[model samples]
Target: MNNSLLIKYGLAGVGLDIVSSADICKHVFHTKASTKRMHTKNDNNNTEYSAVQSEPWSCTERCFPKLICCTYIHKTIANAFHPFIFIPGDGGSQVEAKINKTNSVHYICAKTSTDFFNIWLNLELLVPVVIDCWIDNIKLRYDNVTRRTSNTEGVETRIPGFGSTEPVEWLDPSHASTGAYFTDIGRLLYFTDIVNALVKLGHVRNQTLKGAPFDFRKAPNENQDYFVKLKQLVEETYESNGKTSVILLAHSMGGPMSQYFLNLQKQNWKDKYIKCLVTLSGAWGGSVKAVKVFAIGDDLGSYMLNGKVMKLEQITNPSLAWLMPSRNYWKMDEVLVQTDTKNYTLSNIEDYFMDVEYPNGWEMYQDTLPHSLNLTAPGVEVHCIYGTNVSTVEQVFYKAGSFYENPTLINGDGDGTVNRRSLEGCKTWSSKQKQKVYDLALPKVDHMGILKNVNVLEYISNLVNGL
Candidate 1:
């Protein structure tokens, strides 16, 4: 192989060069096994070898020309995504496997037929009626306190969990669907762009772009069946690619779920299965906004489509309750953000939701979260990326004790939904374990926007390539 290779050596004579064993290993194990974390200390006690290195492949010229150019690039590009798994944010994945009006349970209820008719009329007919009313020069009075006017013209309709305005044409082949709008576009919107970007960088193969979809409506541990499926996917990917450790990229609530799943595994699973975790706007401590939703159900969102108003009403979800700021994490002085002059903690507001009727008792559900310690896997290296620009309400209040009363909102810097303090929870480690935590704060980016942020994507690509 060496004799056939072109050589440019000083003309002392035709000389032979020997390639080191490490060089061969570097090319052969272009997978993460070569980049596995290793630590060594010098006499000066300067510890070395971080979890992430410069790049997984170092193109050195110590080998044959054919081996250097063809073999390395081909193997590295083909096996890139075998070591990566993407975890999506809340409502990031398609929740409904199949939608049948006859078999599906009704999520809405009314006291009387007349009430139902009126509700449907208001929701379905009001938008076009209002538009017509405006065009016909009819004066309509709506109290801003109770009701407000909305005009949706030239605005693209948005589906829940889907970031695109375009209609969905494709659906996941694994699941059959009956709903007209139930398409795979919602699921694709979550991580497909990031996956595609990685694919362009030659760090992710199209076929290996796998999604670990779960019921975000339920708590992480509560959905053991889905976690089992996630585990299977991880194992399959690992075994398929020569036991390469996987790099988990999770966003929003997916981050906590990934943490819970990782915590369930044996301590040594990190060494064998996981390379490191990269979280984007992770709800580590939970969000104060969720508390407001429970205390006073929100309007959710509304849209006008086909001369109809589609309004989504807020409802209590157990998984959302799970995302509520935990006591341990909320009470941390470093992360306890202040709104106006008063400092708000989960303890100060737990009473508001205590009396609120949840599907199950609030106390029973409260028992699910850790009481003393924050929910995080031990010894796993976590790199946190979050947005901090919009003014997030740190606490909600009313003139009286009820949400119906004149309400007031206090705001601070955050990702519009989650505060910077909460997103940075992973960085609040003890001094001994501080080395395991890393973080980056992006300004003026919202929670949902972080998924599409170029900087965030670039950072993730670097992490994947470096790992």
Candidate 2:
């Protein structure tokens, strides 16, 4: 085999993992470094191809020359053998569909359809929706409140819907349903920049099947078709590329989903399919925001004025709750919360969401938040990257004696969304294994910014080279 084809790369992205616009690729790829292309002699002719070279490993001739040489050879061979697979986080992959006046759904895959610039370029149109969502949420809170004469018992305060505001207005002018058109910013821009960088580095290849990105809205295990198709794609990549093992890049919710997928595989699958698992801002432990949304809802429009007005309601979405900090990994019960008149603690905050008993055994699955702790794939090298430094709200307070109304926030350090402690979810796996699990907490990096951060990309590139 030629030196150029030595290593293969597979990249997975975060939630709503939709294919990005070519323009984004073009813009981001050129912003930093260009793709490294080299000429190689093929059987028939000279061809220009992608190439990647690992940084050199040095040895002093005076001491341990043989040892150094062996290490160098092993490192080069290792670098050339593995491919990367990036599993996008929640909302990273999504399908763009359009509905006609007659109600038939048509999927669109054009350049304009994937382009976020067109959708968000008009700040005027977008900003108002955000403001409206924020105002609507505030009103939702006030409207839902049931005033008390003396904080009477047995009277529950009404909970306002909060969290993510769905941009129903942003949908394709033709489609009226929420899921009918994929309108999430996360899916459009999440992996495009990283993909461009990886492709530019060369030697890395995307082995994904067309139109097969996992649906961020659905539970990971529920997507049997996606997983089955992914297995076929993996086999195809390996068969076509001399049986290269995969380096999985899982971000945000993708981290847990990757674990879920790996856990389901045969015990020996890691040896044949995986090389290293690197997670960027993995939400292994669920986020506090998800719990807040589950318990009382949130107005995300107030925080993010990006053209979409999203008021996350106090509703149950098992997938969102799955992002909550794992009970096995965190002492969530010990965490303290306060109210204007009373102080309370959460023994198991996740209990707030799973209160309703489902008819089937499905309640069993949702009730157990940390089932992932047992799903670790043995022998897989693990590396974790997460953002920190932003003030994170670790707990929420309510009006004294009010169970679900008048919530207040307390702060700690984290990305704007996931807190530092939750981002450190990978550490929960340390006690369970002897293998070294690595992590890096970057200052001033927000959850979304990690994607565009040049330093992060370089770090990942180095890791890929080392592999």
Candidate 3:
């Protein structure tokens, strides 16, 4: 084991600098260890570790480096994503990974993800870990929303993780985005841009008639794909290094993805190499926006075009008066906005306004796991980080009953996409919840901002260490 590395992401500090350990092969991963909850009153302050019960994967002799990077949009921190980070290598934006040395941007997590774990080994740091660098895009890009639009000229496209005022940069785009190139520096801005975009939606979408930006709930299957790829990347890392396990740290939506991935591993990955998983502000249950939109919004559920699910209109019926926020509507002749740049000059809300339908895909998900709290289930030692900053985004985007009805007319808390309570879950605490943080659920923070905040690391370190 190594002296604990303190990761200072927000404050003035670089990532972990390791005194390289020896590369060890042929080790047994203990599956009997069980982790404790967040350092709160419920658990009475206890810290012990355990692994899952399954057939373990053996290491092939090789010096491999495990490097996996995720883009929620094009940025590092997302409101709904875990704040896993890395140092930009000489190549700038290209995702890079190494086996022996760690390249980090945050202090605590600066060490390789494997270093974050409390594994008992002599030489090199070898354990299972996951790094989630996905940034949340306020205007979500998913199945329900189309990435581009067909206009009078041709098809107008909405760039991923950008604003009308900035440059349009595209990624491999597992979610959305096409055409041109998205730079490495541009990707770093993914989380921040997403937070700002979603926050501004209350004004752009509701106040103006032209409607706001795009919003997608993200499909469970797509999320599953990203994790699978990440697992492969990490394995490649292990093969590049001698062999190591890692502690997984995922935030917000990543939490649910982590859950889904672990479930897959438990079922088919008994021989898969995964160390541990951690999550922050994940929506294990369906989001409140989904329920509210279906319950409150107009027959907006009818707007599910193609394979797309409607925005937040999650529910079926709603009372109109409650859904309407205020009578003060912004008086504007044409709600449409044309940017200074020719690239982004279209709006999805208007083009697809009349064409809408309910999402039957969501229906199947809801029916099966109305609130599957499996992420923190016992077989695996999962950690959770919850947020308290729902009020700000809520007040801006959603009113009291907005989720149920007139989402177009009212706005509420959350980062404009998910509600606070929904992310926290209906139940406050559970015996199964471990390595948790209720304090990060602050009043000032929004969904995306939490991803970049510096103070989050203290609790994260505690949770990781405790786990």
* Candidate 1 TM-score to native: 0.61
Each prediction's TM-score against the native?
Answer: 0.61, 0.60, 0.38
Cα deviation in Å at residue 230, candidate 1?
1.4
lDDT, model 3, position 285: 46
* Ranking of all predicted structures according to TM-score, beginning with the best and ending with the worst: 1, 2, 3
Residues 4-105, candidate 3, lDDT per residue (tens digit)? 111101111111121111111111121111222222222423221211123333343122222211122112221111222111111111111211223332
Please state the error at residue 247 of candidate 3 in Å.
2.3
Q: Candidate 1 residues 1-467, lDDT tens each?
A: 01112111111112212222234344343422223334566453644332333234345533336555556544443344435677766556543211112221122311122111111112222354343322211111222333221112211111222222111112232333323231212323456557656644533241244556555545653567777777877777777555567777788888888878887788776667777788889888788777666655443232223211111122224566676766655664332323333433555444444444443325424544662145444457788889887888676755433434434667877887876677877776534353387889999988867777899888877775565
User: Model 2 — which ten-residue stretch has the worst lDDT?
Assistant: 159-168
**Which run of 10 residues does model 3 get worst, by summed lDDT?**
203-212
Candidate number with the higher lDDT (2 or 3): 2
User: Each prediction's Cα lDDT score?
Assistant: 0.52, 0.50, 0.30
What lDDT does candidate 1 reach at residue 336? 30
**Superior candidate under lDDT, 1 versus 3:** 1
Off by over 4 Å in 3: 1-218, 221-227, 238-242, 267-275, 291-378, 392-417, 426-440, 461-467
